[model samples]
Target: MLALSAWAAASSRAWAQAPMEPHERDLYEAARREGQVTWYSAQYSADTSEAIGRAFTERYPGVRCSVVRSTSQVAFQRLSQDQRAGVAQCDVFASSNGGHYIQLKRQNRLTQFRPVNADGMLPMLRTADPDNYFQYSSLGIYLLGHNTNMVSDAEAPKSWADVLDPKWKDKLAVGHPGFSGAIGIWALQMRSMFGPDFLRRFERNKPQVGRSSIDPVTMMTAGERAVGVAVPSASTLFAASRGNPLKLIYPTEGVVAVPAPSAIMSNAPNPNAAKLFMEFNTGPALSRITRTMFSESLRPDVPPPEGCRPLDQVTLLSPSLEDADRGVPELREQWRDIFGV
Candidate 1:
């Protein structure tokens, strides 16, 4: 009986001693010594990016998170310039364009590191970057929006086609596909769903075209526009949560799902910090922050914010990775011709 008890104790100790994933202490220790992580993120508004950076720093305590927020194209342009100059200022890159990862991976610009947390993410999100050079960090949805003070619930636009009514003419706002990556994807999806003549007709509404996805929500909040085209759901959620008169319409045709991707630079100045930041970006910590902004989390475990619908429950007009790569550029030129932007 004593020998049997000794064997049982030995087996339990061996099982407990088996090697496991890297501990948070190891990551934090290396990240602490590295000091900071610079993030060039075009995933959300500048303020949102800053808030997330603050949260990351607060969680890690010793490491700093420096955020350079801009539209996805602008962010990518700056990162490209940094690469050309051979200066590694950005530790992580977050862009709204999923195709950017494919381009970066092909160019050997991305450092591959698959986060263990990624295994817990939704299957579709995990496949966003097959090469593991980047990960699907968030979902940016293009939703129809209206001012509750100006448009009644019954009168609010329910579909992309509904925005074309003469009633909404001069009372609509839209983002320019040329300036915003999310808008570019939206333009492509709209073209595919509504046919080529759609935007031409939508143009007659005389939408107040702005350069950012948040423009429509801004217009709606101020009661300047009764309805908005291509308004980001995140902006609408934030506005509604603040008791603003903004409301989102996830068109019956489906809200456009723009998958944002994040990656570490191959020559990151602080690789350890970059890896840790990547884990945090996909982990529950940042997901909670993003949830408030209306961006859908990739993790199944991260519940949607109060009064917000889960991604699985919502009808999303999601384009495959290949379609986005092939269609976005083509749609951009078409958008310019129709919107004359």
Candidate 2:
């Protein structure tokens, strides 16, 4: 009886609220009344991300947004575990793991609401889900990092192949494929290009895998690993700003990009707040946040971030999700067998 009554009330309001921009105007007013939303995010730093959060709360004064940060892989694991245990504490998820989000979309655990700001995205960043279940970030959202004293300017691995060189034997730091979607695609791309020998060839370099996805950067930053696979754009830019001698290797084979999407949970306690938050994040604020973080904005026509090369100029890897999904189980087996993890 209660559920039916609630549905009737919501439908009646939705009807009365139907304007050309009903998605936003209705969401905004409804959100102010609900007042709170929870987000599970995986970000390398709290400051910049939190700045986004703080700015959001300020922007939507009555709508409170709380973010729980975690590593992307770990965050996904938590979400999965929580869901199975019937402890759905998270209201939304914002992360750079497209493959995982794709799996979630398959399960229909997500709400489908097209963002009012979808028109702002670049052609490449757009998702099939016109609703905001997922959205891709700009090119090389993660970057290559190397120890200054070890890899020289001209000697560094300009392309992904350079990392396979035996010179860096056991000296290279690679991200754990499961934890790092950036590396997961890199791994898939490696196999996609090189066949079964790729991991064995990579092994000759004796790449050390990080615990979390960002471990490679941590290793490179400490000079523990001479050459590393990926670093958050924030860390790369901050290091570059200080003239850290670290280089951003815009892949000669083209930078790979994946969706760092935000999704609203189906059973969200604060659906109104969640909707408002998503709209706020996906709009002008996302453009500003991404631009500030040195990421290519999803808004396609927007220019590349400062100190970044244009995506068109570099070689890119177009991953087939269908292929990626098929390969994941086998890929994980291959990684374990080869890496002996």
Candidate 3:
């Protein structure tokens, strides 16, 4: 055991000191001088985001990662506030909404950067932004999840429309599109698949709505809710691994695959550190960190998380860039009207 521990420590050191490409080295040197990067992130849970931050610091010793985690809309709102105040506090902006990137790019709020590691991502994810204003830094599947202690597998929701059944009234937990960017997209997709009146129908169920996509997972874990509507698969599986009574249900309507994009701010307080962080976001270190958390790995060389179905194996529903750009805001307004929150 002692020898094994030593070997593992040695391997970690070797990996940390591994050769960097010319671009990475240049950025690292400048980033070290900058000392820290502030990341406004809505891509993962707070704990997961902090873990990624710690790993990034471990990989690039002289630089520090400062993480500010919130729901997508909240994070974006904070960034907007900063912009209005003429403060360049955020270095990198990571959001679950692709539509946010579209708007930011249009406003010239994002720096045009193409990470060298971006080329290492899966081909589909690689082309997320042809203009190089943002890159897909994280991926998650949104689906139904349930507390095993409260709901049997046979009794769980098997389709997106299943949660709307009168039987699930007061027993369902869902994220609010007005707060969560991923939920905004999910709401838009649900509308596309069902109809414009989908939220009106769902509202009748009296489901508990939370601000972030991960909130439904928490409700299920506490047995406060029997089912989660449009919850993130990664956090659900990670909760299950920790002995929570959670189980994912890939709805018959197809799972919504959310690609979270991260971009450097046009007025980054630490531009070099921000660029370095962007590269790290798509690199092997982040992939390895997220894989154990049951999140999808963007890199082809990394295997799918232990409990996740590989992207290719699952039927995925994704909003087009244009659809998301137009639909998310519309859905947010509709959500506010229907949920009244």
Candidate 4:
């Protein structure tokens, strides 16, 4: 778990609740009767997810938010199992992989409800699904990160290709694409930039592979690994803030900007609560909570996280909906074949 900092805890407590409009008030009332919202989330750390859930409960007063946090693939698998068993346990689904939304929307498994707060988000991140089945709830960059104590700035890997150098052999950490959606996308992007054999070359470095993308940062902070191949910028920066010897490196090629999205499930048992939770996700409270945790803020009113550049100022690389839908699955299999994990 990522430890919540004193600043983050204080920020969460200090956030003022915004008065709901008539439509939101009606939804909140209906959601109160349902009592709680269950969220299967893969976008943030468990602590951060729980913090957001607590913030939602505090803001609305009656409805509770139950958070089930996991890596993207694990969360999707659990949701798929629930559906297969004819269970409607998840009220809302948030995943780091955009491809999951595409697949679910095709099967008519997602509820199409546009949040009133969608207009408050950054204009570029607003549209994950044109039909409004899913909205970008979180944004993060995937880039290189190193343990500052082990590797000085001058000696650290400067670009994506730098990690492949033999000098870093057995000193690298990475996330498994088979488990992490963001890592799947990052692997796909690496393939696009380098070639099909990129992972094979990367495998030669003997990286310590972990299930979630955040794991790479964890390894670096522990000094178990000197460098992270592709790690989430938010967690890396957060670790640095906590006095961890971590530093992020935006690759010369481009940073992979991932827009983690959320949507209501069509068969949600607490349908009204799900809609209310979706609205809460795009609202100011969640934005404030995420910003304090050093993650991207979806709302325009919330500034970018401390220690990070504004999203617009960074050169970001993203997969198209079609590319991500097709590519991520393939990358997972390829990753398993190459890494044997």
Candidate 5:
């Protein structure tokens, strides 16, 4: 009996001694140093960021994290401003624009540090830049949603072609292209799906343009507008939770998908902590809530929210990184002319 007890104890210890996944172990080690990593993200909801920040601190115990919330463009702008001022405040950046990532890389602002799990990423996602400067989330298509107060799901349109209907004329709400990456892709898709002539034609529809892309979601939810060209699934949920009647649709011809990407700041005061932040943000800690949040998870191992369309099955109107980089400037100018806003 004594020998058996000892063996049982040894087995339990052995089982407990099994190693953590590489990234988790790295996070643990980095956290032990008690350094700070500041994150720049457009994904700011006080509740969610706080919850995530608390969870991370609990998991690591030693590390400190500060989240600087702003729009993606704001994030980029701040990074530029911080560098110009010789003040290093942000240690990580997360955005949905590939064009921004490529530009940052070209400027030698990115650090060359690949995550341990990057080898598992899709080939199309791998840019082969020496630095794993950019890591992208799993792709998710933009959705057009209707205000339930203004229209029922039955009355709601199911396809992009429905967007041009006469009833929605001048009533369509869309975000500006120069700002929102996801909405910008909507512009790209419009250009590709319908051509430049479509923009001139779409103008007759007189989309009530919002300076920020998220305005469509806000206005539609408030019932100030009947429809929005595209809104984040998560943002829709955020509004829905507040009792807004927002019904979403994935256009039949398919909607454009924007890839959200994250990067560690090259001059991050704590490189190891920055690495840990990348690892933790991409892992189960952040991924598990994707369903509830109305967005897709970045991990291939994870599945989409229930009732959401399989992104693969949806018609892909997503722009290539190269094309988006080259095309956005000209297109934004065209949009300014169309709206004169």
Candidate 6:
């Protein structure tokens, strides 16, 4: 009797540890038949996005993952436009701004399907809607970055106040809050950390503004800018790995962490494929890719990239969902007023 009970307990534990059920097998088969999943994402650049898509295709044979990559605001606008026209082309949507999913869920635009891999994800990465409408798939740190060749270690700025120095006028790069979700959150953090007058004063430096967070590294790589206040550390690390002379500076104040969330569209043409894509993201296979990009992994077991400190070790500044949703609009308007973008 004891031997039988022990065997039964072990079987139960194995069942609990399984990644999927019979119903999920049905979903996988259906996804195979569908053959394609359309992904609209602003989580990364086109290259990284395409890499993720290709990885998904390689994982699930016969199923292609088509990615439409852009800035978060532009991607959201495109998704919204498609929805309004009654032609939903996006099967999955990922944005750095979590507020988008909240608004979509409220409007019944997001489908509810919990990925089986969610069970293994870190608690910090599981901040989806109560109904499981979305899941955070990627993370980036928003802070200062510089061209190592242009700015020596002694000349590197260490804090938020240092970037405002007149020495960087016309030599600084930043992202526009109206376009990049990373910038929107960083703007919110800045406004909360500093006063409204801070932006007006910083604008006097005449910083070059771009639509994507990744643009700063591009500007730095091209020798167009010496410093960037809005570059993602992951992008910097990736560029540095390619011998681009880029380096990230974790501001003495704090680094702003951007968590990009992915969700299924309510009117998805290929629901099964969308679910499979979500599973692939939260599953074990994608951690290596994310690490290669120097992004903070959703799985705690996966350590951050070398030379990049772990999330917990970094001093971080994050706005609440309510603060972000409420403050982004005001900050964008103020930013335009100051920078004249």
The TM-scores, one per candidate, come to 0.89, 0.85, 0.95, 0.96, 0.84, 0.91
What is the per-residue lDDT of model 1 for residues 89-123, given as tens digits with 9 covering 90 to 100? Answer: 99999988776777788899999888777778877
lDDT winner, 3 or 5: 3
Better of 2 and 3 by TM-score: 3
Query: lDDT value for candidate 4?
Result: 0.88
**Candidate closer to the true structure by TM-score (higher is better), 1 or 4:** 4
Model 1: per-residue Cα lDDT at residue 210: 87
Candidate whose TM-score is highest: 4
lDDT of 6 by residue, 1-341 (tens): 24433543454344334565665567779999999999997987776677678777765668899989889999989988997798979999998887787788889988988888877887877756677888878877888989988998789999998877888888899998889988999988887888778888789889999889888888999999999887988788878877788888888988998877899999999999999989878865566555666666778766666668877778878887667777887888999888889
Clashing pairs in 2: 121-300, 122-298, 122-300, 136-259, 170-205, 253-315, 254-315, 254-316
Candidate-wise lDDT, in order? 0.79, 0.66, 0.88, 0.88, 0.69, 0.81
Candidate RMSDs in order: 9.5, 9.3, 2.7, 2.0, 7.7, 8.1
Candidate 6 residue pairs in clash (backbone atoms < 3 Å)? none
Residue lDDT tens for model 2, 95-143: 5555666788889888876666766776665564554565543334555
Candidate 3 stretches greater than 4 Å from native: 1-14
TM-score of 5: 0.84
Q: How many clashing pairs per prediction, in order?
A: 0, 8, 0, 0, 1, 0
The 10-residue segment with the lowest total lDDT in model 3: 1-10
- Residue lDDT tens for model 4, 56-105: 88877889999999999999999999988998899999999999999999
Any runs in candidate 5 off by more than 4 Å, and if so which? 1-19, 31-34, 43-50, 119-131, 138-140
Badly placed stretches (over 4 Å) of model 1 are 1-21
Off by over 4 Å in 2: 1-25, 43-45, 130-133, 137-143, 232-234, 300-302
Better of 3 and 4 by TM-score: 4
